[model samples]
Target chain A: MSNHDTHEHGDPIAEIKKVTIILSVLTIIELILGFWMIGVTSEGGRLAIKGTIVILMLAKAFYIVAYFMHLKHELKNLIMTIVVPLALFIWFITAFLSDGNSFRNLRNTYDPHFKEQATIKVEAKEGHHGEEGAHATEAKEAAPATEAKEAAPAKAAETEKK
Target chain B: MSNVTTASTKEAKWWNGGKSPFDVEYGKVMMWYFLMSDAFTFGAFLIAYGTVRFSTNGWPNPNEVFKSYPFAGEGTNAPLVFVSIMTFILIVSSVTMVLAVHAGKMMDKKGVVRNMILTIIGGIAFLSCQAWEWNHLHHEGAWWGMNPFINADGTASSTNFTNFFFTITGFHGFHVFSGVVINIIMLIMTLTNQFEKRGHYLMIEKAGLYWHFVDLVWVFVFTCFYLL
Candidate 1:
């Protein structure tokens, strides 16, 4: 190939390397931020840390897609073909997440009475031994270790049979 | 073959010195379209995961749940350090893949082969790390069930959340494994001078696109699953 053809080909490999280095540095920063965020107590500080990490991740993603995937060099129509579908999909995600989140909120606030009744039934099923009753009640208040353990074995057996 | 006919049509159009509609090589154009379709599949899976996660009132903190190693009893002390190392390994492999593509462009066969070997090794390491992660997750008492949130009564608040997490990540891991296999094949082909007669290193470039896509998807996975 002539020097002109060489130049026309453009050293995408070199560009890819440059982007790779940037992504590496950003990933290290993400790791540090992730560790640091785990130590933060304040909600605002946590949010800031999360927002920064998410932004950095998106930046890394953009670099890989644009450079490695050669989207930057592609025709405008091709780019739109790839991007528009992604935008539409994000809309679906948003709608589903909003509905799901609302359902969870309703369950947490408005359905506690039904949940308590369910817990009572579970306690009854476990024979309601004095210590076990206390544990079950505590599990209802905190994490439900006993119920998970009991349910887990039964599920495992069923799955094994399947 | 149909492909030959299509190639002939493409050549006839470009043979007359007319601009190709896509402004990209046919192989490259096809790869983009394939990737776009794949992206939609991945997007659907992720959206499903988000729906399930949102439906759960008390999702288990991923940092806590994924922290335990083989022997370490579950506790706050374990901090998912293994995944961090896996992430670093994958990033390094991506860098080596770029270097391989660089060597291919420069027509340095030795450099290409060396870097491809290194890239393949990095890929294997990544696979091993993923295997370890999978084993850890699937072990009994490790709660392979897909409940992102632990209910107050200690049962999974929603099994759907955990199921989606595992299925999506597992599918992505399978893709990585296949990519590594392809990289290995390309590496062997290069060592044997398969591309020497072709007079071009487009295969390396294509593989680089694929390897980079795996890395890109992982970046999103890391954000949505681990960081979020």
Candidate 2:
């Protein structure tokens, strides 16, 4: 194939260095956005930052595929062959996520126990969160939580039957 | 004579039989398609994760879950620090892989060996970091169907968070392990002058493609699980 001959003219090393810089810069931007996101508790602000992160993510993906994977040097038809099929992801993500949201709505409307569980906040222990030292006490505390969880569902079932 | 010329030109077209329309070799084409299928596999996993997260009312804040790194004191409040390091390692390895591919193109065996070794080291380091993170989380009572951390809002959380975390990262770690093995084998072949004898280094190119694909997947996983 002429594929080997096609890319023989360019300075491949220089191209690699350039793309490396681009990828790194993009990742740093993404991390900065991520760290900034952790401190922001506002809903709209978080959404906007998340949207920016996703955009940067896609840009990173493009660099990796187009440069690192050498897809840009390939023929037009070859690029199409790969890119066209990926369009399916748009539909796939939309359908799955929307369905998941719908399922949550349905559960909230129909299942009183499921709705109640989310509203009830667990009391935070004074310290020792998720540490080995806290395991004993955690187990002790979880026992009643489990019993209460089970009791809530049974009560919901009884109410439904009535 | 006109009929003969028309027939000859028709056969010479790019899409005509006896030549690749994409101008690349059959192996590279197959590799691309294989990576495409693998992409779908990972896509299915992350999408499934999204579905579960959407259906659930509360998710454990990832900042609370993945805060500690190696050598950090207990109860350190550093979130995304460890993961960003992991992300950088993978990206640097990917850059090394690209360099190796370029070296292979030049038929510079020493350059190929050097870059491949660096790539392999990077892979192993990334895998080790993953192992530490997994072990640490397990110590915190996180596992399949078990979650110690409550939701971001303090409500009792579902087990799906840890479930997806372990399963997806485990699968990605497996890919990194296999990529490291492939790179080791490539390194050996380069050292042994296998590509020199073959008069081409197409094999390294293919392995580099796989390695870069692994890095590409991590970008998504990091975003979906840690950042978002």
Candidate 3:
């Protein structure tokens, strides 16, 4: 290339090395946190650990974008143009996750037969007709395990017999 | 457009503007725009993942699910050691990409070529590691053909987590694969004197932006999928 003077960007080697180090450090910290949090049983402790690791992850992301991708040196508007729209995704996540959670809660409450144990509860509300009712009652009596949650495992083993 | 008069341009001068409006070359400005949109795309995928995770009653423990490493067979030393290595590969590749862009500015064709090659190799290595992980997961039991959600039958399966795991990582893996492909083409062009003939290696710099974006996405993936 003849006109090296045309592209007058500064030497990025030093910044690259710094970023590499920072990233490595963050990675190590996250690894340690992941493992350490595994043993933590308390919900609060786990959430706190999750928060810490997320912050570290974002830090690494910033270095990769700014130094390696060269965005840090670019015009401020260029950065804003990206960040402004990207910020909306946070809202999207919040909206969707809450909606999904509500859906799950509704399913768990109403879909009693959806899980094995919920079968007994549904059977109580369900009325039986003449001849089939007696045979079905006999079948229910033949089955083992009364706990609702055990319904799944009990049904699984019962099916194995067939 | 209505004309706005300025002091220096009182006469009809040859110059139209003093500096680039975006304050960068047209190619670079466009690349940034492309990457920004792409970042949001990845963000939406991750958000969907988080939604699925929250909605599911029994989300598989990611650490337990990802415990196996390549060749260790079944139980492994650390849950996320392999993915951590993958992360390292991408991070180092981003660094090499920086060197490539730096070399491009200095007009060192050889340095640019070498670093681009290294970056490409790193990308390939990352994809290989991912494939290994996927294969290991398959044999360890969840594949596309087998549904993790066995429903009311009570089979020991990972219904929700597996779905999102495959979806999110597969998407990011696709991105990494494409970045590698782009780098290979850029490498070929660099070696064949395409950019040299153009008098600047901005091509390498642009590819570096893409490589860094891929790495950036991996950071989020590693956190959301493996670590968190």
Candidate 4:
């Protein structure tokens, strides 16, 4: 007679109110941590911050899926039926991400666009090299380089199509 | 008939005509299966996003990308405060949905009607927030980066971050929008006394399952697109 599985008995309203407060507070903690991580500027420290954010996020995901989705009250078999396949999704994303890294490296090696980017850097450096402290000449030099940068991508596309 | 064996009665129960291995309501079990399939679709979109983001080093910072508020600081990037409010709205709506289901259980018709209305309002509010976000992002040329063919940032705009941003969030937003429509239908049915005729409010519970699914999916979308 009692839907005890969902805690829908004996002050059920109070139970849900408590859950709401908890979820809201957790979200606040997440936002604060995110901004705090911003203040730490070391590259290695940044990676640590990213990992912590991910961990906090997974905790939020757990509460949402468990209490909100009511999966926490479902029978063990049904819960496993959903959770097992979701685990595979993590593996799936990792595999694809590795493949993406390979493609990025390959593009840098093969795409002529990389060459154009390099040319801009070289020109910018040369302009800075001469004490010709004339800001106007540097601006003029930067204009042609950027124009070439735009034209360069179109040429790469043509070669790619060929 | 009085002398019938207990074994015979057990064998003759109505389940003899059908199977329920999980020993739960048929409708609820079916809803679980449906949610699993839907989860797979969301997972695939997010996985594609991960692949693209990983491949391109030129992906824009999420904080800088999503930091604009509606009217204030239209030119500045103060990251995540607006979407955080959006998250709160959806969660509050989810709370109202649960309360509606609770009312249905107690056969409190007025309670059900009031809570359903509140839940529907919450859903509409979330959808309105999304429409505003989409309009703002469009004006800011975010969609231009989403176009795979358009390299707006010289060479770093590789259609990686922007493409997934629109596709994943847009998909979640569509689900929230539909949840609102379904809630409105449930509200109308409650007003018409349909649940009274049925003698139970399992329909509301089913819809609650669906609305919760929408909220759950948003948690992941918020993490993937905004927080992390």
Candidate 5:
């Protein structure tokens, strides 16, 4: 049979090669920009560098899905089957980030001093007798704040020197 | 009696061939379904990663942590250049895979073999590059501002973010390694004239799909883990 007869079967290989070249060139350009902008001083410069990298990454992803995955040739229903799930997945990521951030904020509000005091008390009463243990526990409870207060002058002196 | 049987066989053959609804092969359709499932699996991992990153306070800046290589040690300020190279290598391999697929379509088995070999090499090279990046990250000491649980010495203690970094990227790297083996097997099959007899290079085309998937995952990882 002539090649024309076989053409209906789809020529994936030809499409793959064209897409690959485009992806490779784009990747190389991304690498170059990543290197050249290594010492970007300004915040704008930093954002610019970040933006370029993200854009290149997306471009690479687009080529792979479009060509390698055969989404380019698939029927509309099949393409939607792939794309819709992907959008929902991104939404989940956003939600996860928000929840995680909120939890972190709540954790930050608890007093670190209380945790430090509790830790010291747990350590100091390791092996003492009943009365000694109680005294040691009380002392441990009070010690961190006193120590913290005492250390303030030293910290102040250090700051003055700086 | 023989004439009667022959007439019945002819009628059945015409009916079966005239209006077949499904023209595509079962294996090809199945591969597409499998790919869709795999994409969801990866999406779940990425979303989990985002959750962890969000929950943590003072997440390390990707640009600061992943500065370019070669001069990375000089200022400790360069962005993730090595990872970017790894990304580039993968993209290049995807290209080679496409070229191989093209050669397969033309029935130039020699070209297919050469391009497949090139693609395999690219994959191996990318994996090696990733290994080096991981080693560097592991040896770097933990940062001070990281999650502090305090130690016996009254000093602030921290956990290694490197561990999480390695886990996510390492898992993806293993996938790439598997893809390489798959490519090698497909290459061997192509060389034996297996595809030639079938009059199609569907096996190579499927391999291209897999290789491209690897590239796609890395793109997201590179952004979320290295470029963010």
Candidate 6:
């Protein structure tokens, strides 16, 4: 502890307060955007909102890591050691997500059942029950729900044989 | 001799052999790297989630699934309200952790204990909220392979929705659980005057890092599962 005189000479308590406020505000904005997203029906608008949420999410992460975790105050070497390897995530996300998109395209093109499932709209049940009724009907509801779930995979398997 | 001098001088003062390169202790460095590896773990899980979500044609809209709060009755339509509360709890607890670390820097045991206790309370509160949400979902028949909700477009959805939800959130919850345990142990050590005898509360700083990492992970998990 004696050898560690590396922390910046500043009012750390004040800095903590500032960072806390920033994190909270970021979260609130993100929530607002989330609520806005629910009301937005257009695909482009939802994407723009979602993209903003992501940027805000990254900002919140930066504040948490830089201030709360004190990474920004650390030595340059230490910071590089930590941050550089994280670059791997860029390619990680790109490759995986692109592959996923490709997989979806392939499935939709070849897998008849997969395409059919998307087109088949089931009735929206009165799924959410009152708190008092929830407990009583939990068991009764589980039977049909599980039966439907089981039937889905069975149907997929039957389709595969064709 | 000139070449050797140039090479030696190129290295920063802290990087010189007589002192630690990072100007911090080995414990803190290890904790950072541990968190780094842990970040990859979470990243992989989230990426896998993204992969599955992209590959699937339909998904349960989070707004529909997470639209209830505690004591708000079973048919509440309040999306993101409960989760926002949970998010604030974690952020506030993280602030308390910062205070604990700051108090440790000032050698104030009382401040450290108070903040640590508050942090533990926050952790427990978050876990309780999660328990309620999970129970609610379970009641609605959402489990590893069971999903009661349909896709946003009113299509028959895949079980992957419930499957990924449980696995990722469950993993993050496990991290939170472990973080609480670590904080509890730190609390006990503080109470026993262990850091007092050692003349430093570096251990608390390390614990704070772990706790903040837990909070950090929650940011991603919340966005991935609840918000996005």
Q: For each candidate, give its TM-score against the true structure.
A: 0.77, 0.89, 0.78, 0.78, 0.67, 0.88
Residue-by-residue lDDT tens digits, candidate 6, B44-74: 9999999999888888799998999988875
Candidate 3 stretches with Cα past 4 Å from truth are A1-11, A109-162, B1-19, B145-158
Writing each residue's lDDT as its tens digit, candidate 5 over B1-228 gives 334323433243322544212223456556667777877777777777666655554344455455536434544545665776787788778777877876776888988999899999999999888876655443332222221112222222223344456666877898899999999999889888889998888788778878878888888877767655
What's the residue-level lDDT of A19 in candidate 4?
79
The candidate, 4 or 6, that scores higher on DockQ is: 6
- lDDT (tens digit, per residue) of candidate 5 on A51-135: 7777887787777787776575554545665678678766776788788777656655675752353334222212111111212
Question: What is the C-alpha lDDT profile of model 3 across B87-113, one tens digit per residue?
Answer: 999888888888887788787899988
Model 5 regions lying over 4 Å from their true place: A1-56, A110-162, B1-24, B67-78, B141-160
- Recovered native contacts in candidate 3, as a fraction? 0.50
What lDDT tens digits, residue by residue, belong to model 1 across residues A50-155? 8899789889888878876667655466687777877886679779889888877777678985345334422222311111232345445555454534544444
TM-score for chain B considered on its own, for each of the candidates: 0.83, 0.94, 0.85, 0.86, 0.77, 0.94
Q: Better model by TM-score, 1 or 3?
A: 3
lDDT of 6 at B60: 79
Clashes of each: 6, 0, 1, 0, 9, 0
Minimum summed lDDT over a 10-residue window in model 5 chain B is located at B141-150
Model 6 segments more than 4 A misplaced = A1-7, A129-162, B1-11
In terms of docking quality, model 1 is acceptable
Q: Candidate 4 on B1-228: residue-level lDDT in tens?
A: 322222232344434545343434778778878888888899889878877766664544566566677776535658788899899999999999889988988888999999999999999988988999888765443452332222213233444566678888888999998889889999999999999898878788888888988988887788777766
Cα displacement (Å) at residue A150, model 6: 14
Task: Chain A only: list TM-scores of all candidates.
Answer: 0.64, 0.75, 0.62, 0.60, 0.53, 0.76
- CAPRI tier of model 4: acceptable
lDDT of 2 by residue, B1-228 (tens): 333333433244667656577767788999999999999999999999999999998888988888999998876889899999999999999999998888888888999999999999999999999999998887666777666677888787767898899999999999999999999999999999999998888999999999999999999999999999
Ten-residue segment with the worst summed lDDT in candidate 3 chain A? A125-134
Question: What interface RMSD does every candidate have?
Answer: 8.2, 6.7, 11.9, 9.4, 14.3, 6.3
Q: What is the DockQ of candidate 4?
A: 0.25
Q: Quote the lDDT for A28 in model 6.
A: 97
Ranking by DockQ: 6, 2, 1, 3, 4, 5
